[model samples]
Target: MSRGLLRSTAVFSAMTLLSRIAGFARDTLQATLFGTGGAMSAFIVAYRIPNFLRRVFAEGSMSMAFVPVLNEIRERGDKAALKDFVDHMAGALCAVVLVVCGLGVLLAPAIASVFTPGWALDQPDKFAWTTQMLRITFPYLLFISMMSLAASVLNSFGKFALPAFTPVLHNLTLIAAMLWLAPQFDIRPFGLAWGVLIAGALQLVLLWPALGRLGLRPRLRAGFHHPEVRKVAKLMLPTLFSSSVAQVNLLVGTVFASLLVDGSQDWLYYSDRLIEFPLGLFGVAIGTVILPHLSRRHAATDAVGYSGALDWGLRLALLAGIPAALGLFLLAEPITATVYNYGKFEAFDSRMTAISLTLMSLGIPAFMLSKVLSPAFFARQDTKTPMRAALLTVAANVLLTIAFTTPLWLYKVEGAHGGIALATALAGIFNAWLLWRYLRRAGLLQPQPGWGRFSLQLFAACVVMATIVVGLRLWIGSWTEIAQPTHRIFWLFVVIGAGALSYAATLLASGLRPRDLRH
Candidate 1:
């Protein structure tokens, strides 16, 4: 059982790594060509509003609600019922997204005003660009939402590869759009908005045929009044905020960031992207693979199996998240300067980006832990607990943002946006602790043996790894001074590779074995 779960996660992570590599290229090109200027900031805001909703309505809340119920119906051996439920779900999801997308297009200007009222007032051109791009990108919610439904069905059916690779195509499309399509448009950056719309439809189409292979092609049936449909909608409500706390907090940060400099939003967006690398590679892969497993274990009343899966997820989270956080925090400046300090992106922009990236790196372990913990509640169809956690976390984030950023904004301090990153990190840690305490109180998480030894091994490994990385950084000074970009990239790899190997060797030398991870 451990091997199966590990294999699935490995497969998913490998595919996601390719997508991340593609995304790296996309961002490198985007930063080089556009830089963190008024135009790119406009694109970031327009893209973010829809992307945030995609997480809320499509990937985050929607998947958590739909998967366990699908597992339940599958457990009961009810093919007809499953088909009926899926059809109604498709129609119902589409029906709602259509209206939402329509309203989004109609109110693009007002919506942009709300998120960035500062821009609307101070930079009217940026605001107009935001409204224009938003009108193009708003329909992406409908396409990506349907694609998520298809992905949920495929995941439950144990076909993980196709859905995992869809993002590869998504990124590739955007890269092509930037190179070829951007110049063709009147406003060159409008091509990025068009790229999003095209990519969403392409991904949905890519996943649709896979469902037919499983005999689960959903023929749309608007059974909004259907009991199962209503059940899913009800299950979806609390997760609306709970499953997407990070995104909600970032959106809040966007509001505050608008008051800073022109490219403040771009800096936050790029730094958050850096934070998501290990997160998408390991954290998301582990969470996605385990949720259905936990749901099935719960359906069978196999408490032992459920606990074991949670334990595995928790251990893996710490194993990957800690080293990732340390690496990002230690190398934030070099990494930023090497990748993005070309074309229009200047040293000033790199410095600003590194500030936020360093602060946000502190939240990696917490973000990963919450990813594992929230699924524990959702697997049992208990969404309200995480929702409560979500509410407090966001509230705390707002208060913290105000406390942290207001003083900086008041004083006209440089890099004021880092305060937003700091608040987001602190709130994430608070949320993870709350969920951990809730799970203990509810008696859902029974810690397996060796937690003490396991934690110690991780601590020792990280300490060794950090020492090596810092020494290397101090020896190889002045990353941005290298005339050749390839030289900088090569040295950066050398540093990362050494740290990774040092970490693994320390673990093995400390008596940690591969078999320990499996069982």
Candidate 2:
């Protein structure tokens, strides 16, 4: 990363950290209110429908497809032309989102059934609740897709803070719902669904002024035949399928989880949410900052800049991901026990969630690598390669999900949900491996000098961090046995702070410097 890129990434990461903290609070409240129960499972699955679409169409596909093209146009120094392109793309995307949202609402029951097959047949109450919430939450796709589009535009213009902060609105809305609206609802999670709907609108509204400040506010004019819009359409098609593989894998997990015991979906949901903390704070923040930067370099045929960006992103991902993965693996139980394990959430539920979190933590490196690397191909307008990788990943996940989940389910194992999380984690590595392999074959990503030493140093630091966490865990005893939540929270922070401090100290002692992160 260049200093400029690093600064931008830091800005985004800080905002994302705030958002993740708020998200943690929202989730903690949700777990308190619902626990790993039928209602929580229903909301989890119902919410997945639009969230999946948001990833596929809004953020993943359209944003990736739009940024490079927009960057090129902006680089050409034609503000009027750029504005025209933005308007046409906005109109086209909004039209598609409206149609999709309408269909999603209309077919909520079928959509609910497809993702949660076990619920539709054997768990009718869960099924009905899922469908109802799906109908309420599905419009989130429309609002959030537009929000994503606006954010991509801002990112392309080198404006990242507002976009990064938008998710805080989402978490705040959900937290507010949990505190107030949920109590009024007969079905408590229903309030969360409504909150999703409201937050989507608020997120989109929040970005309009940012766009206006840039004098790039879209006019919602139909121009499907505009050359740039057509190019974006072509790029979005394969990218949609390609970039959505992760979401697809999650959907696959949800399908299998639905068939497991009653609390399986909730377990996976909470575990995945915990896994997302580090990912959201660092992995995604880095990826978001890098995409437009890579797009600009790729457009200018600046191979050196492009390669350096990729190298920096990969190394930084490892630098951050390794410690995070290790910390999560070491402190999974305590993290779960502290963040959840209140009210309706029990010690058993915390144990199960921790099991899943630990298994999922094993894949953090792969997940972050994929998050940073995919944009390399996307920036070069090569979505087909990633689409191929995504297909293989989905297939592998299916086989693995079945392979790992069958015995657990058949034998009635205590932590069967962990099997699904384990499969997802393993499949993520395969997906990331394929992506890295393709990037190598295409000669798009070249490792920068010092990578070998950097890797060694990173490994050493992570080892130190892991040792500290393990030592702390041994000294503190099991979290569930702790009498007070406040003490559990204190010890959890002690372990995390000590591990982080040790990791940083070891990295410095091993000759890794702040300057080493620079490209």
Candidate 3:
């Protein structure tokens, strides 16, 4: 990547790290306050419904489509047209999502029933809570989706940090709600749902001033039939699946998990959160920065810059993603036990969460690869190929979920939810492979030289890091057996820090350098 782009990515990643830290605090509070089984599972169901779709239309597909066109407009140097497009898109998205939110709120019970039919059948109380929370949280899709639009605009203009930092407010809001508000409710999970609602609106509000500073504050002129608007609409249709394949697979797991034991949903949800930490901190930052860079490169017809950016993103993603995956897989138990096993969240819950976390960690590389690869397609306005790949990936996910989870369910496996996670991981690998294959076949991605050396260095570092982490982890015995939560937390960080230092040292010794990442 160019030095400027690298700086932007770093800015975004640093801000994302703050947000992720805040997110850990929020998750810890939620686990301690709400635990896993009944109402937390209900909240997960309700939250995932809208949140998954938010990833689809907001950060995933919509930005993929919007950024390229927005870059095209900006490249034309027509400020009026640029502002017009932003305003119209703002109004159109708001109009559409408002209608969808209304429908979601109205259909809350039916939506809840569809996702958790088992709850409806046997656990009516959980079903009712799902519906209630869904009613409260559905509108989050509207607010957060708009916030993403604002963020996309900010990113296209090279203002990465504000957009990246906005998520911190979201985490803080939830933390506050859990700490102060949850205790007031007769049913505390209601506080979580309220937090979701408030966070969405607050995040959007938080970005408004940043938008104004850019002279791009949307005035909300509805223009669905406008040519640019129609083009974005056309693009969004295919990406509905293509952009959010992982989230789609997770929703599939959620549906299947509903039929399993009570806490299966929570187990899957918490494990997914753990895996998302690395992804959000790095994979997403790469994707977010690269999209606009690639879009501008495409608009300028800079093939060399485009390919270099793609190459750089792939190399960086692997350097961070592979080791992160291995580290998470190695430390799943300690990580889960330290982060979650508290208050009402028992050791069994932590153990179950670790099972899923370990399995899901396998998908991190594929997930990060797709993060970069999908944007390569989207940057060039080529959504169809990824859409086709996404279709097959999701189909494979469903089949694999059944194949993996069915036997676990039949045999009465203790952590049947882990099978759902394993299937998702495998499906993600398939999805990334498909995207990579598509990119290669199209002759759009030409790997820069030294890839073989890069691969070897990554492998060497991972092996070294894994050996050290495992050695220390074994020496420490078990995380759940630790007497104090603080002690467990302290040791987990020690192991993680040592592993990170070893990985970086090995990489440096193997001839990987900061300069190599720049060019």
lDDT of each: 0.93, 0.89, 0.92
TM-score of 1: 0.99
Clashes of 1: 0
The C-alpha local distance difference test score for the whole of candidate 3 amounts to: 0.92
> Which 10 residues in a row give candidate 1 its minimum summed lDDT?
181-190
The residue-by-residue lDDT of candidate 2 on 1-519, one tens digit each, is: 489889998999999999999988888889988787778788898888789899977889888889889998988999999999999999999998899989988998888989989888899998999999999999899999999999999888788999999989999999998889888999898989899999999999999878998889999988689999999989888887678777888899999988889898888889899989888888898899899989989888999999999999998898888888888888899999999999999999999999999999999999999999899998998888998999899999999999999999999998888888998999999999999999999888888888778878988888888888888899889899997889988888888999999999999999988887875
Q: Ten-residue segment with the worst summed lDDT in candidate 3? A: 1-10
Candidate 2 positional error at 195, Å: 0.6
- Reference-based TM-score of each model: 0.99, 0.99, 0.99
What's the candidate order when arranged by decreasing lDDT? 1, 3, 2
lDDT of 3 at 187: 90
Please give, for residues 383-500, the per-residue lDDT of candidate 1 as tens digits: 9999999999999999999999999999999999999999999999999999999999999999999999998999999999999999999999988887799999999999999999
lDDT of 3 at 60: 84
RMSD (CA, Å), candidate 1 to true, equals 0.8
In candidate 1 the C-alpha lDDT for residue 172 amounts to 96
Could you give me the TM-score of model 3 versus the true structure?
A: 0.99
